[model samples]
Target: MSILSDDIPALILIDIQKGFEDISSWGTERNNPEAEENARILLNLWRSKDFPIFHIQHCSSEPESLLNESNHGNDFKDIVSPLVGETIVKKNVNSAFIGTNLRKLLDTENISKVVIVGLTTDHCVSTTARMAGNYGYETYVVSDATATFDKVGVDGQLFSAQLMHETALASIHEEFGLVVSTKEIAQQIN
Candidate 1:
Protein backbone atom coordinates (compact mmCIF):
# COMPACT_ATOMS: atom_id res chain seq x y z
CA MET A 1 0.00 0.00 0.00
CA SER A 2 1.27 3.46 -0.84
CA ILE A 3 1.69 6.08 1.85
CA LEU A 4 -0.36 9.24 2.03
CA SER A 5 0.60 11.96 -0.46
CA ASP A 6 3.73 10.11 -1.38
CA ASP A 7 3.63 10.57 -5.11
CA ILE A 8 7.23 11.59 -5.58
CA PRO A 9 9.18 8.38 -5.06
CA ALA A 10 12.87 8.08 -5.85
CA LEU A 11 14.68 4.78 -6.27
CA ILE A 12 17.75 4.88 -4.02
CA LEU A 13 20.33 2.25 -4.98
CA ILE A 14 23.03 1.76 -2.37
CA ASP A 15 26.48 0.25 -2.80
CA ILE A 16 25.81 -1.76 -5.91
CA GLN A 17 29.34 -0.88 -6.90
CA LYS A 18 31.80 -3.29 -8.47
CA GLY A 19 33.88 -3.67 -5.33
CA PHE A 20 31.08 -5.34 -3.43
CA GLU A 21 31.12 -8.26 -5.85
CA ASP A 22 34.85 -8.50 -6.55
CA ILE A 23 35.98 -8.29 -2.93
CA SER A 24 37.00 -11.52 -1.15
CA SER A 25 34.13 -11.04 1.25
CA TRP A 26 31.50 -12.08 -1.32
CA GLY A 27 33.29 -13.46 -4.38
CA THR A 28 31.96 -17.03 -3.98
CA GLU A 29 28.38 -16.55 -2.95
CA ARG A 30 25.56 -18.61 -4.43
CA ASN A 31 23.15 -15.74 -4.92
CA ASN A 32 25.60 -13.14 -6.17
CA PRO A 33 24.89 -13.65 -9.84
CA GLU A 34 21.15 -13.87 -9.34
CA ALA A 35 21.11 -10.73 -7.26
CA GLU A 36 22.86 -8.75 -9.96
CA GLU A 37 20.33 -9.92 -12.50
CA ASN A 38 17.45 -8.97 -10.25
CA ALA A 39 18.94 -5.53 -9.61
CA ARG A 40 19.29 -4.95 -13.34
CA ILE A 41 15.60 -5.63 -13.83
CA LEU A 42 14.62 -3.07 -11.21
CA LEU A 43 17.03 -0.47 -12.56
CA ASN A 44 15.64 -0.90 -16.03
CA LEU A 45 12.09 -0.38 -14.83
CA TRP A 46 12.93 2.81 -12.94
CA ARG A 47 14.94 4.15 -15.84
CA SER A 48 12.11 3.47 -18.25
CA LYS A 49 9.76 5.55 -16.16
CA ASP A 50 12.29 8.37 -16.02
CA PHE A 51 12.01 8.31 -12.29
CA PRO A 52 14.58 10.02 -10.13
CA ILE A 53 17.29 7.40 -9.58
CA PHE A 54 20.19 7.96 -7.24
CA HIS A 55 23.22 5.73 -6.69
CA ILE A 56 25.47 5.58 -3.65
CA GLN A 57 29.05 4.51 -4.20
CA HIS A 58 31.24 3.46 -1.28
CA CYS A 59 34.86 4.49 -1.40
CA SER A 60 37.68 4.26 1.09
CA SER A 61 40.98 6.14 0.98
CA GLU A 62 43.05 3.11 1.93
CA PRO A 63 45.26 2.18 -1.02
CA GLU A 64 44.76 -1.58 -0.81
CA SER A 65 41.07 -1.60 -0.03
CA LEU A 66 38.64 -2.93 -2.62
CA LEU A 67 36.84 0.40 -2.66
CA ASN A 68 40.07 2.18 -3.49
CA GLU A 69 40.80 0.29 -6.69
CA SER A 70 40.76 2.52 -9.77
CA ASN A 71 38.98 0.15 -12.08
CA HIS A 72 36.71 -1.99 -9.93
CA GLY A 73 36.24 0.02 -6.80
CA ASN A 74 32.76 1.36 -6.34
CA ASP A 75 32.10 1.98 -10.01
CA PHE A 76 29.03 1.00 -11.96
CA LYS A 77 29.77 -1.30 -14.91
CA ASP A 78 28.91 -0.83 -18.58
CA ILE A 79 25.91 -3.11 -18.25
CA VAL A 80 24.23 -0.34 -16.32
CA SER A 81 24.58 3.21 -17.57
CA PRO A 82 23.12 5.29 -14.76
CA LEU A 83 20.74 7.76 -16.29
CA VAL A 84 22.36 10.93 -17.50
CA GLY A 85 22.20 13.77 -14.98
CA GLU A 86 21.12 11.47 -12.16
CA THR A 87 22.97 12.26 -8.96
CA ILE A 88 25.62 9.79 -7.74
CA VAL A 89 26.34 10.26 -4.07
CA LYS A 90 29.83 9.21 -2.92
CA LYS A 91 29.89 7.65 0.51
CA ASN A 92 32.55 6.15 2.76
CA VAL A 93 30.06 4.40 4.99
CA ASN A 94 27.05 2.06 4.81
CA SER A 95 24.23 4.52 5.11
CA ALA A 96 23.78 6.60 1.96
CA PHE A 97 22.38 9.58 3.81
CA ILE A 98 25.32 9.89 6.17
CA GLY A 99 27.60 12.83 5.41
CA THR A 100 26.09 13.06 1.94
CA ASN A 101 23.69 15.31 0.13
CA LEU A 102 21.17 12.51 -0.34
CA ARG A 103 18.83 13.76 2.34
CA LYS A 104 19.04 17.30 1.05
CA LEU A 105 18.51 16.12 -2.49
CA LEU A 106 15.38 14.24 -1.50
CA ASP A 107 14.13 17.19 0.49
CA THR A 108 14.75 19.52 -2.42
CA GLU A 109 12.71 17.28 -4.67
CA ASN A 110 10.02 16.92 -2.04
CA ILE A 111 10.25 13.15 -2.11
CA SER A 112 8.27 11.48 0.63
CA LYS A 113 8.71 7.89 -0.50
CA VAL A 114 11.81 6.02 -1.60
CA VAL A 115 11.98 2.67 -3.34
CA ILE A 116 15.28 1.05 -2.35
CA VAL A 117 16.95 -1.72 -4.37
CA GLY A 118 20.57 -2.74 -4.47
CA LEU A 119 23.27 -5.26 -3.51
CA THR A 120 24.16 -6.87 -0.18
CA THR A 121 20.86 -6.83 1.61
CA ASP A 122 22.36 -7.07 5.09
CA HIS A 123 24.78 -4.22 4.80
CA CYS A 124 24.26 -0.96 2.94
CA VAL A 125 20.78 -1.91 1.85
CA SER A 126 19.56 -2.68 5.35
CA THR A 127 21.28 0.30 6.92
CA THR A 128 20.05 2.77 4.33
CA ALA A 129 16.50 1.43 4.53
CA ARG A 130 16.42 1.89 8.27
CA MET A 131 17.91 5.36 8.02
CA ALA A 132 15.37 6.41 5.44
CA GLY A 133 12.55 5.28 7.70
CA ASN A 134 14.06 7.14 10.61
CA TYR A 135 14.13 10.26 8.44
CA GLY A 136 10.35 9.98 8.12
CA TYR A 137 10.31 8.88 4.51
CA GLU A 138 8.23 5.90 3.50
CA THR A 139 10.75 3.29 2.38
CA TYR A 140 10.02 0.16 0.39
CA VAL A 141 12.53 -2.65 0.11
CA VAL A 142 12.13 -4.46 -3.18
CA SER A 143 13.07 -8.02 -2.11
CA ASP A 144 14.40 -9.54 -5.33
CA ALA A 145 15.93 -6.17 -5.97
CA THR A 146 18.21 -6.77 -2.97
CA ALA A 147 20.44 -9.75 -2.08
CA THR A 148 23.25 -10.83 0.22
CA PHE A 149 25.74 -13.63 0.68
CA ASP A 150 26.36 -16.16 3.42
CA LYS A 151 27.93 -14.95 6.63
CA VAL A 152 29.27 -16.92 9.59
CA GLY A 153 27.71 -16.02 12.89
CA VAL A 154 29.12 -15.89 16.43
CA ASP A 155 27.64 -19.33 17.11
CA GLY A 156 29.83 -20.85 14.36
CA GLN A 157 26.84 -21.25 12.12
CA LEU A 158 26.66 -20.05 8.54
CA PHE A 159 23.61 -18.25 7.28
CA SER A 160 22.78 -19.01 3.66
CA ALA A 161 21.68 -16.41 1.15
CA GLN A 162 18.07 -17.55 1.37
CA LEU A 163 18.17 -17.41 5.14
CA MET A 164 19.59 -13.89 5.14
CA HIS A 165 16.99 -12.75 2.67
CA GLU A 166 14.12 -14.14 4.74
CA THR A 167 15.48 -12.84 8.03
CA ALA A 168 15.91 -9.34 6.63
CA LEU A 169 12.37 -9.36 5.33
CA ALA A 170 10.95 -10.51 8.64
CA SER A 171 12.88 -7.98 10.67
CA ILE A 172 12.35 -4.81 8.65
CA HIS A 173 9.56 -5.41 6.18
CA GLU A 174 6.69 -3.91 8.13
CA GLU A 175 8.60 -1.54 10.36
CA PHE A 176 10.92 0.20 7.94
CA GLY A 177 8.93 -0.24 4.77
CA LEU A 178 6.83 -2.69 2.82
CA VAL A 179 8.75 -5.61 1.39
CA VAL A 180 7.92 -5.98 -2.29
CA SER A 181 9.12 -7.88 -5.34
CA THR A 182 10.32 -6.44 -8.62
CA LYS A 183 7.18 -7.71 -10.31
CA GLU A 184 4.94 -6.08 -7.73
CA ILE A 185 6.88 -2.84 -7.91
CA ALA A 186 6.64 -2.76 -11.66
CA GLN A 187 2.91 -3.43 -11.45
CA GLN A 188 2.45 -0.55 -9.06
CA ILE A 189 4.46 1.86 -11.19
CA ASN A 190 2.75 0.75 -14.36
Candidate 2:
Protein backbone atom coordinates (compact mmCIF):
# COMPACT_ATOMS: atom_id res chain seq x y z
CA MET A 1 0.00 0.00 0.00
CA SER A 2 2.07 2.90 -1.25
CA ILE A 3 0.90 6.48 -1.10
CA LEU A 4 1.46 6.90 -4.83
CA SER A 5 0.02 4.96 -7.70
CA ASP A 6 1.18 1.44 -8.49
CA ASP A 7 2.85 2.65 -11.66
CA ILE A 8 6.35 3.98 -11.07
CA PRO A 9 6.46 7.77 -11.53
CA ALA A 10 8.67 9.62 -13.95
CA LEU A 11 10.47 12.50 -12.27
CA ILE A 12 10.16 15.75 -14.24
CA LEU A 13 12.62 18.45 -13.21
CA ILE A 14 11.93 21.77 -14.94
CA ASP A 15 14.34 24.57 -15.75
CA ILE A 16 16.87 24.15 -12.96
CA GLN A 17 19.28 26.31 -14.85
CA LYS A 18 22.02 28.79 -14.00
CA GLY A 19 19.93 31.57 -15.57
CA PHE A 20 17.61 31.50 -12.55
CA GLU A 21 20.54 32.62 -10.37
CA ASP A 22 20.29 36.11 -11.88
CA ILE A 23 17.89 37.23 -9.16
CA SER A 24 17.85 40.84 -10.29
CA SER A 25 16.45 39.75 -13.63
CA TRP A 26 13.91 37.42 -11.99
CA GLY A 27 12.68 39.62 -9.11
CA THR A 28 13.70 41.45 -5.96
CA GLU A 29 13.12 38.36 -3.83
CA ARG A 30 12.73 34.58 -4.30
CA ASN A 31 11.40 31.97 -1.91
CA ASN A 32 12.51 28.44 -1.01
CA PRO A 33 16.26 28.64 -0.86
CA GLU A 34 16.26 24.90 -0.18
CA ALA A 35 14.26 23.96 -3.28
CA GLU A 36 17.27 22.57 -5.13
CA GLU A 37 18.28 20.46 -2.15
CA ASN A 38 14.81 18.99 -1.84
CA ALA A 39 14.74 18.23 -5.53
CA ARG A 40 18.11 16.54 -5.21
CA ILE A 41 16.72 14.33 -2.49
CA LEU A 42 13.93 13.17 -4.76
CA LEU A 43 16.33 12.75 -7.65
CA ASN A 44 18.52 10.53 -5.56
CA LEU A 45 15.54 8.48 -4.49
CA TRP A 46 14.52 7.93 -8.10
CA ARG A 47 18.07 7.06 -9.07
CA SER A 48 18.25 4.46 -6.32
CA LYS A 49 15.07 2.92 -7.67
CA ASP A 50 16.15 3.29 -11.31
CA PHE A 51 12.95 5.13 -12.17
CA PRO A 52 12.40 7.39 -15.18
CA ILE A 53 13.67 10.98 -15.17
CA PHE A 54 13.13 13.90 -17.50
CA HIS A 55 15.17 17.06 -17.20
CA ILE A 56 13.26 19.95 -18.78
CA GLN A 57 15.40 22.82 -19.99
CA HIS A 58 14.14 26.21 -21.07
CA CYS A 59 15.73 27.45 -24.26
CA SER A 60 14.69 31.05 -24.43
CA SER A 61 14.32 32.62 -27.88
CA GLU A 62 15.08 36.10 -26.50
CA PRO A 63 18.70 37.08 -27.16
CA GLU A 64 19.05 39.02 -23.90
CA SER A 65 17.42 36.36 -21.74
CA LEU A 66 19.78 34.47 -19.47
CA LEU A 67 18.28 31.17 -20.62
CA ASN A 68 19.13 31.90 -24.26
CA GLU A 69 21.11 29.14 -25.97
CA SER A 70 24.08 31.45 -26.54
CA ASN A 71 24.71 32.12 -22.85
CA HIS A 72 26.32 30.29 -19.93
CA GLY A 73 23.11 30.79 -18.00
CA ASN A 74 21.47 28.26 -20.24
CA ASP A 75 23.53 25.53 -18.64
CA PHE A 76 22.09 23.39 -15.88
CA LYS A 77 23.17 24.05 -12.31
CA ASP A 78 25.47 21.29 -11.02
CA ILE A 79 23.10 20.14 -8.31
CA VAL A 80 20.43 18.68 -10.59
CA SER A 81 22.31 18.42 -13.88
CA PRO A 82 21.16 15.64 -16.15
CA LEU A 83 23.30 12.56 -16.27
CA VAL A 84 24.22 10.77 -19.53
CA GLY A 85 21.09 8.61 -19.55
CA GLU A 86 18.40 11.08 -18.49
CA THR A 87 16.00 12.57 -21.01
CA ILE A 88 16.42 16.29 -21.73
CA VAL A 89 13.40 18.10 -23.07
CA LYS A 90 14.12 21.63 -24.25
CA LYS A 91 11.23 24.02 -24.70
CA ASN A 92 10.65 27.69 -25.46
CA VAL A 93 7.34 27.86 -23.63
CA ASN A 94 6.31 27.32 -20.01
CA SER A 95 4.81 23.91 -20.64
CA ALA A 96 7.28 21.04 -21.16
CA PHE A 97 4.95 19.20 -23.55
CA ILE A 98 5.01 21.94 -26.19
CA GLY A 99 7.46 21.44 -29.05
CA THR A 100 9.06 18.50 -27.30
CA ASN A 101 8.82 14.72 -27.28
CA LEU A 102 8.07 14.67 -23.57
CA ARG A 103 4.77 12.91 -24.13
CA LYS A 104 6.13 10.46 -26.64
CA LEU A 105 9.02 9.59 -24.37
CA LEU A 106 6.70 9.09 -21.40
CA ASP A 107 4.33 7.01 -23.46
CA THR A 108 7.20 5.08 -24.95
CA GLU A 109 8.35 4.19 -21.47
CA ASN A 110 4.78 3.34 -20.48
CA ILE A 111 4.84 5.88 -17.67
CA SER A 112 1.57 7.39 -16.49
CA LYS A 113 2.74 8.97 -13.21
CA VAL A 114 4.84 12.11 -12.99
CA VAL A 115 6.48 13.87 -10.05
CA ILE A 116 7.28 17.50 -10.96
CA VAL A 117 9.85 19.64 -9.17
CA GLY A 118 11.66 22.80 -10.22
CA LEU A 119 12.28 26.54 -10.19
CA THR A 120 9.63 29.26 -10.12
CA THR A 121 6.59 27.50 -8.73
CA ASP A 122 4.21 30.05 -10.23
CA HIS A 123 5.35 29.87 -13.82
CA CYS A 124 6.86 26.89 -15.64
CA VAL A 125 6.20 24.52 -12.76
CA SER A 126 2.51 25.43 -12.64
CA THR A 127 2.11 25.35 -16.39
CA THR A 128 3.76 21.94 -16.74
CA ALA A 129 1.75 20.51 -13.84
CA ARG A 130 -1.54 21.68 -15.36
CA MET A 131 -0.71 20.19 -18.74
CA ALA A 132 0.44 16.92 -17.15
CA GLY A 133 -2.87 16.55 -15.32
CA ASN A 134 -4.87 17.46 -18.42
CA TYR A 135 -2.89 14.88 -20.32
CA GLY A 136 -4.29 12.29 -17.89
CA TYR A 137 -1.09 11.46 -16.04
CA GLU A 138 -1.05 11.07 -12.28
CA THR A 139 0.74 14.33 -11.53
CA TYR A 140 2.29 15.42 -8.27
CA VAL A 141 3.77 18.88 -7.83
CA VAL A 142 6.34 18.85 -5.02
CA SER A 143 5.62 21.94 -2.93
CA ASP A 144 8.86 22.29 -0.98
CA ALA A 145 10.91 21.31 -3.99
CA THR A 146 9.56 24.20 -6.06
CA ALA A 147 9.89 27.96 -5.58
CA THR A 148 9.10 31.36 -7.11
CA PHE A 149 10.20 34.98 -7.25
CA ASP A 150 8.21 37.96 -6.09
CA LYS A 151 5.83 39.42 -8.64
CA VAL A 152 4.42 42.89 -9.22
CA GLY A 153 0.73 43.12 -9.97
CA VAL A 154 -0.75 45.08 -12.89
CA ASP A 155 -1.15 48.10 -10.58
CA GLY A 156 2.43 47.74 -9.31
CA GLN A 157 1.50 46.07 -6.05
CA LEU A 158 4.20 43.74 -4.83
CA PHE A 159 3.37 40.12 -4.07
CA SER A 160 5.90 38.22 -2.01
CA ALA A 161 7.53 35.15 -3.45
CA GLN A 162 6.09 32.96 -0.68
CA LEU A 163 2.57 34.17 -1.46
CA MET A 164 2.93 33.40 -5.13
CA HIS A 165 4.39 29.98 -4.37
CA GLU A 166 1.60 29.07 -1.97
CA THR A 167 -1.20 30.22 -4.24
CA ALA A 168 0.20 28.39 -7.21
CA LEU A 169 0.39 25.13 -5.23
CA ALA A 170 -3.11 25.67 -3.89
CA SER A 171 -4.45 26.33 -7.37
CA ILE A 172 -3.18 23.01 -8.64
CA HIS A 173 -3.83 20.82 -5.59
CA GLU A 174 -6.73 18.40 -6.05
CA GLU A 175 -7.70 20.23 -9.25
CA PHE A 176 -5.02 19.88 -11.87
CA GLY A 177 -2.74 17.76 -9.71
CA LEU A 178 -1.76 16.73 -6.22
CA VAL A 179 0.51 19.13 -4.34
CA VAL A 180 2.88 17.12 -2.14
CA SER A 181 5.91 17.56 0.08
CA THR A 182 9.26 15.88 -0.39
CA LYS A 183 9.09 14.24 3.02
CA GLU A 184 5.74 12.72 2.20
CA ILE A 185 7.14 11.34 -1.00
CA ALA A 186 10.19 9.91 0.74
CA GLN A 187 8.10 8.30 3.44
CA GLN A 188 6.33 6.29 0.80
CA ILE A 189 9.56 4.49 0.06
CA ASN A 190 9.55 0.84 1.16
Candidate 3:
Protein backbone atom coordinates (compact mmCIF):
# COMPACT_ATOMS: atom_id res chain seq x y z
CA MET A 1 0.00 0.00 0.00
CA SER A 2 1.10 3.58 -0.52
CA ILE A 3 2.54 5.46 2.45
CA LEU A 4 -0.41 7.80 2.03
CA SER A 5 -3.54 6.78 0.29
CA ASP A 6 -6.29 8.86 -1.30
CA ASP A 7 -7.46 9.75 2.16
CA ILE A 8 -5.42 12.61 3.53
CA PRO A 9 -3.81 11.77 6.85
CA ALA A 10 -3.59 14.01 9.89
CA LEU A 11 -0.13 15.10 11.02
CA ILE A 12 0.25 14.47 14.76
CA LEU A 13 3.27 16.18 16.31
CA ILE A 14 4.13 14.95 19.78
CA ASP A 15 5.92 16.89 22.49
CA ILE A 16 7.93 19.23 20.29
CA GLN A 17 8.59 21.42 23.27
CA LYS A 18 11.46 23.59 24.40
CA GLY A 19 12.10 21.23 27.32
CA PHE A 20 14.10 18.98 25.00
CA GLU A 21 16.73 21.68 24.75
CA ASP A 22 17.80 20.86 28.29
CA ILE A 23 20.14 18.14 27.05
CA SER A 24 22.53 18.67 29.95
CA SER A 25 19.75 17.97 32.41
CA TRP A 26 18.46 15.06 30.34
CA GLY A 27 21.90 13.54 30.96
CA THR A 28 22.22 11.78 27.62
CA GLU A 29 23.66 12.28 24.19
CA ARG A 30 21.17 12.85 21.40
CA ASN A 31 20.90 12.00 17.72
CA ASN A 32 19.20 13.76 14.82
CA PRO A 33 19.98 17.35 15.61
CA GLU A 34 17.94 18.30 12.56
CA ALA A 35 14.82 16.51 13.72
CA GLU A 36 12.86 19.72 14.42
CA GLU A 37 13.88 21.08 11.04
CA ASN A 38 12.54 17.98 9.33
CA ALA A 39 9.40 18.21 11.40
CA ARG A 40 8.98 21.83 10.29
CA ILE A 41 9.22 20.77 6.67
CA LEU A 42 6.48 18.20 7.20
CA LEU A 43 4.35 20.68 9.11
CA ASN A 44 4.63 23.23 6.31
CA LEU A 45 3.70 20.58 3.81
CA TRP A 46 0.63 19.62 5.78
CA ARG A 47 -0.42 23.25 6.17
CA SER A 48 0.16 24.04 2.51
CA LYS A 49 -1.95 21.07 1.56
CA ASP A 50 -4.72 22.14 3.95
CA PHE A 51 -4.64 18.76 5.70
CA PRO A 52 -5.59 18.01 9.26
CA ILE A 53 -2.88 18.57 11.89
CA PHE A 54 -2.80 17.79 15.58
CA HIS A 55 -0.26 19.08 18.05
CA ILE A 56 0.30 17.00 21.18
CA GLN A 57 1.69 18.93 24.10
CA HIS A 58 3.15 17.01 27.04
CA CYS A 59 2.11 18.80 30.23
CA SER A 60 3.96 17.22 33.14
CA SER A 61 2.25 17.24 36.51
CA GLU A 62 5.43 17.07 38.55
CA PRO A 63 6.69 20.39 39.87
CA GLU A 64 10.30 19.54 39.12
CA SER A 65 9.65 18.45 35.57
CA LEU A 66 10.69 20.84 32.83
CA LEU A 67 7.51 19.98 31.00
CA ASN A 68 5.33 21.28 33.78
CA GLU A 69 2.97 23.98 32.48
CA SER A 70 4.40 26.66 34.75
CA ASN A 71 7.88 26.21 33.34
CA HIS A 72 9.09 28.07 30.27
CA GLY A 73 10.40 24.79 28.90
CA ASN A 74 6.87 23.50 28.70
CA ASP A 75 6.06 25.82 25.83
CA PHE A 76 5.89 24.43 22.31
CA LYS A 77 8.94 24.96 20.19
CA ASP A 78 8.49 28.01 17.99
CA ILE A 79 9.27 26.04 14.87
CA VAL A 80 6.33 23.68 15.33
CA SER A 81 3.84 25.95 17.03
CA PRO A 82 0.21 25.31 16.23
CA LEU A 83 -1.59 27.68 13.97
CA VAL A 84 -5.09 28.93 14.59
CA GLY A 85 -7.74 26.31 13.80
CA GLU A 86 -5.26 23.48 14.17
CA THR A 87 -6.06 20.97 16.88
CA ILE A 88 -3.96 21.01 20.04
CA VAL A 89 -4.14 18.01 22.31
CA LYS A 90 -2.62 18.28 25.77
CA LYS A 91 -1.48 14.92 27.06
CA ASN A 92 -0.01 13.97 30.40
CA VAL A 93 1.05 10.52 29.28
CA ASN A 94 3.12 8.94 26.52
CA SER A 95 0.35 8.04 24.13
CA ALA A 96 -1.55 10.94 22.55
CA PHE A 97 -4.59 8.68 22.40
CA ILE A 98 -4.64 8.49 26.17
CA GLY A 99 -5.97 11.36 28.30
CA THR A 100 -6.89 13.21 25.12
CA ASN A 101 -9.67 13.21 22.59
CA LEU A 102 -7.21 12.68 19.76
CA ARG A 103 -8.73 9.38 18.75
CA LYS A 104 -12.21 10.77 19.00
CA LEU A 105 -11.34 13.80 16.89
CA LEU A 106 -9.75 11.57 14.25
CA ASP A 107 -12.73 9.28 14.21
CA THR A 108 -15.10 12.20 14.06
CA GLU A 109 -13.24 13.59 11.12
CA ASN A 110 -12.94 10.14 9.61
CA ILE A 111 -9.17 10.41 9.51
CA SER A 112 -8.08 6.82 9.01
CA LYS A 113 -4.42 7.61 8.38
CA VAL A 114 -1.89 9.51 10.50
CA VAL A 115 1.64 10.83 10.00
CA ILE A 116 3.41 11.11 13.37
CA VAL A 117 6.58 13.02 14.23
CA GLY A 118 8.12 14.36 17.40
CA LEU A 119 10.65 14.32 20.24
CA THR A 120 12.18 11.34 22.02
CA THR A 121 11.65 8.58 19.47
CA ASP A 122 11.81 5.81 22.06
CA HIS A 123 9.24 7.29 24.42
CA CYS A 124 6.17 9.29 23.45
CA VAL A 125 6.54 8.84 19.70
CA SER A 126 6.78 5.06 19.88
CA THR A 127 3.96 4.73 22.35
CA THR A 128 1.63 6.93 20.31
CA ALA A 129 2.47 5.14 17.07
CA ARG A 130 1.73 1.77 18.66
CA MET A 131 -1.62 3.02 19.91
CA ALA A 132 -2.45 4.61 16.56
CA GLY A 133 -1.87 1.29 14.85
CA ASN A 134 -3.84 -0.70 17.42
CA TYR A 135 -6.60 1.86 17.14
CA GLY A 136 -6.70 0.96 13.42
CA TYR A 137 -5.17 4.04 11.85
CA GLU A 138 -2.78 3.59 8.93
CA THR A 139 0.18 5.20 10.67
CA TYR A 140 3.41 6.49 9.15
CA VAL A 141 6.25 7.57 11.44
CA VAL A 142 8.76 10.04 10.03
CA SER A 143 12.14 8.77 11.18
CA ASP A 144 14.20 11.90 10.54
CA ALA A 145 11.52 14.08 12.05
CA THR A 146 11.95 12.40 15.41
CA ALA A 147 14.90 11.78 17.75
CA THR A 148 15.92 10.19 21.03
CA PHE A 149 18.74 10.33 23.53
CA ASP A 150 21.31 7.67 24.43
CA LYS A 151 20.37 5.49 27.36
CA VAL A 152 21.97 3.13 29.84
CA GLY A 153 20.31 -0.25 29.82
CA VAL A 154 19.36 -2.29 32.86
CA ASP A 155 22.67 -4.16 32.41
CA GLY A 156 24.54 -0.83 32.75
CA GLN A 157 25.47 -0.92 29.08
CA LEU A 158 25.19 2.41 27.31
CA PHE A 159 23.40 2.51 23.98
CA SER A 160 23.95 5.26 21.48
CA ALA A 161 21.06 7.55 20.62
CA GLN A 162 21.24 6.47 16.99
CA LEU A 163 20.97 2.82 17.97
CA MET A 164 18.00 3.42 20.25
CA HIS A 165 16.25 5.53 17.65
CA GLU A 166 16.70 2.96 14.87
CA THR A 167 15.75 0.08 17.14
CA ALA A 168 12.54 1.83 18.13
CA LEU A 169 11.65 2.38 14.50
CA ALA A 170 12.43 -1.23 13.61
CA SER A 171 10.28 -2.53 16.44
CA ILE A 172 7.20 -0.87 15.00
CA HIS A 173 8.02 -0.86 11.28
CA GLU A 174 5.94 -3.78 10.03
CA GLU A 175 3.44 -4.48 12.76
CA PHE A 176 2.62 -0.96 13.94
CA GLY A 177 3.32 1.11 10.87
CA LEU A 178 5.80 2.11 8.22
CA VAL A 179 8.90 3.99 9.26
CA VAL A 180 9.71 6.64 6.64
CA SER A 181 11.49 9.96 6.14
CA THR A 182 10.23 13.51 5.64
CA LYS A 183 11.42 13.67 2.03
CA GLU A 184 9.66 10.40 1.17
CA ILE A 185 6.39 11.52 2.69
CA ALA A 186 6.63 14.85 0.88
CA GLN A 187 7.13 13.04 -2.39
CA GLN A 188 4.08 10.89 -1.75
CA ILE A 189 2.04 13.98 -0.98
CA ASN A 190 3.12 15.64 -4.19
Off-target runs (Cα >4 Å) in candidate 2 are 1-4
TM-score of 3: 0.97
Alpha-carbon error at 97 in model 3, in Å?
0.7
lDDT (tens digit, per residue) of candidate 2 on 65-173: 9999999999998999988988899999999998999999999999988999998799999999999999999889999999999999999999999999999999999
The per-model lDDT (C-alpha) reads 0.77, 0.93, 0.93
Candidate 1 global lDDT: 0.77
Candidate 3's C-alpha runs over 4 A off are none
Tens digits of lDDT, candidate 1, 1-190: 7533448589887777777665455634545455566667768877887878898777766767777646475577545547778788888777898889999999998898998887768888888999999999899998887877777789978888778777877777889888888777777777
lDDT of residue 160 for candidate 1: 85
Backbone clash pairs in model 3 (N, Cα, C under 3 Å; residues 3+ apart or in different chains), count: 0
By TM-score, is 1 or 2 better? Answer: 2
lDDT of 1 at 84: 75
lDDT of 2 at 70: 99
Worst 10 residues of 2 by lDDT: 1-10
